[model samples]
Target: MEQHYQLLRKHIEEICVLTDEEWDVVAQRFTYKSLKKHQFLIQKDQLVPCEYWIIKGLTKAYAIDSNGKEHILQFAMEQYWTSDFNAFQNKVPATIIIDCIEDSEFFCLKWEDREYLCHEIPKLNHFFRIKSHYGYIALQQRILSLLTETAEERYNNLIKKMPKLIQRVPKKLLAAYLGVTRETLSRF
Candidate 1:
């Protein structure tokens, strides 16, 4: 539990330093959770009560279309955050589902607690703002890639940017993420 908190501190410190007092305040607001492989973290049409910071293992955020095809949106691992951002922010039902790819542990922060922490600590607010900016930029880049790049190009770019992801995520999930069939992905 202490180690998980330390990991959270390190993740935040990458953006901005936190004083001990502030850290204590920030730490207490989070609750620990663990889930086994294949467990649902956020199910579609359900409420998203908190955003989770991964302490260990991997998870995938995806949506199932009316035809029952899974569309992978994101893969989150240790030190990464995962949530149904649209629902979490709007206080509505989730449009996507998040599930554990492996047994996972996380520190969960409810929306109200997050808001309180941001208001109480200016540096924490700055850290979150920077993190959100990066997330937005990444999302934009992903959209542009899907719109303009071929599957092969996207695969090459993903390998170049996040080789570890290729190694960690299953090929089928990678295929879905790249908007390609498994057979097509196999050719790359």
Candidate 2:
């Protein structure tokens, strides 16, 4: 538990420095949570209360279509921050689901708590803003890849970008994320 907080502190420091007192305030606001393999973190139509910072383990954020096919948006692993951002920010019911791919631990920060922390700590606000910008850039790149690149090209790019993720996630889920069939993914 202490190590998890330390990890979060380190992750934040990568973007901006935090004083011990500021760190203490930030740490106290985050609540720890654990989930077993295959457990739901956010279910569609439910209210999403917090954004999670992964301490350990992997999860998938996805949606199920009317035909019951899954469309994976992204995977989250150690040091990643994830949530149904639309729902969390808008205070609306979630449209997507998040589920643990492995036994996972996270530090959860509620919207109000996050707001308070950002207000109290200017560096924290900068940290979060920088993180958001990175997230947006990643999203844009993903969109461009999907629109312009072939499946094989996308696969190669993903391998280069996050080889560890390729090893940790199942092939089937990878296929879903790449918008390819499992059989097609196997060829890459």
Candidate 3:
């Protein structure tokens, strides 16, 4: 647990330095948890009150359409912070589902703690703001790829960006994420 906390500290310190006292205060607010593959972190229609920073393993955020097809919005891996952002920020019910793709460990921070820390520690605000910006940029790139790129093109780009994903994530999930069928993905 102490080692995992150090990992979180290192992730934050990359954005801004935290004093020992400040780090202590920040660390105390988070609760650590572990989840098995197939466990749901945020289920659709449930209230998602916390955000999580992945310490190990992988997860996916997706929405199921009326036809019961899953459309993956994003993948969260080690060092990434993920949650139903709309639900966490607005205190609303989740529209997307987040589930573990592999056995995972995370540091969870409740909304109250996050709000308080953002105000109590200005550097923490800087850290979160930077992460948010990068998240937005990634979203934009994903949208552009979905709008214009062929599924094969998207698959190639995804492989280039995350070669290990093909090995780690199930092909069906990867196919859904790439807007291709599993058979189509196999051809690539």
Candidate 4:
């Protein structure tokens, strides 16, 4: 547990330098959990009061459409943080489900704990806000690209931008995220 706490501390340090005492306070609020593949970390439309940091393994945030098609919104791998933003920020039920794609270890902080950390550590809040800002910016870029770019161009951009994802994530899911059919993606 101490080692994991140190890992969290190190990750926090990357975002911003934290004093030893501040790191201790931040680490104290997290608890670790292991999840098996195909397990639901969070279910769609459920109230999710916690956000997670992936210590190891992969998780995906996705939603099922009316036609029962799965649309993947994002993937979180090692050293990444993930949560249903709507539920975490607005205290509303989640529309996205977070599922483990591989056996995983994660450190989680509940909403109340997160609030306490933010209130107590302004730098932590700034760190998370930066993350949020980057995420929003990426989402906006993806939307604009989808609206204006050709499918082949999108595929090439994805390959260049997220090469690891192309290698690790299933092609079908990657295709869906790119708004191209699996067959189309295969050709690219």
- The true-versus-predicted C-alpha distance at residue 157 of model 4, in Å, is 1.8
Worst 10 contiguous positions by lDDT, candidate 4: 162-171
Ten contiguous residues with the weakest lDDT in model 1: 122-131
* Candidate achieving higher TM-score, 2 or 4: 2
lDDT of 1 by residue, 85-184 (tens): 9999999999999999889999999999999998999778888888889878888999899999999999999999888889988898999999999999
| lDDT of each residue in 116-174, candidate 3, tens digit only | 89999988999999999999999999999999999999999998998887889899999
- Clash number for candidate 1: 0
List residue ranges in candidate 2 displaced over 4 A: none
TM-score of each: 0.97, 0.98, 0.97, 0.92
Q: Model 4 over residues 73-167: C-alpha lDDT tens digits?
A: 78888888899988987888999989998898999999899889999998889888887788898779888888999999988998898778678
Better of 1 and 3 by lDDT: 3
Pairs in steric clash, model 1: none
Worst 10 residues of 3 by lDDT: 161-170
The TM-score between candidate 3 and the true structure equals 0.97
Candidate closer to the true structure by lDDT (higher is better), 3 or 4? 3
By lDDT, the candidates rank as 2, 3, 1, 4
Ranking by TM-score: 2, 3, 1, 4
Model 3: C-alpha RMSD to truth? 0.9
Candidates in order have lDDT scores of 0.92, 0.94, 0.94, 0.87
Candidate 3, position 43, lDDT: 99
Task: Return the lDDT, model 3, position 137.
Answer: 95
Candidate number that wins on lDDT, 2 or 4: 2
Tell me how candidate 1 scores on lDDT: 0.92
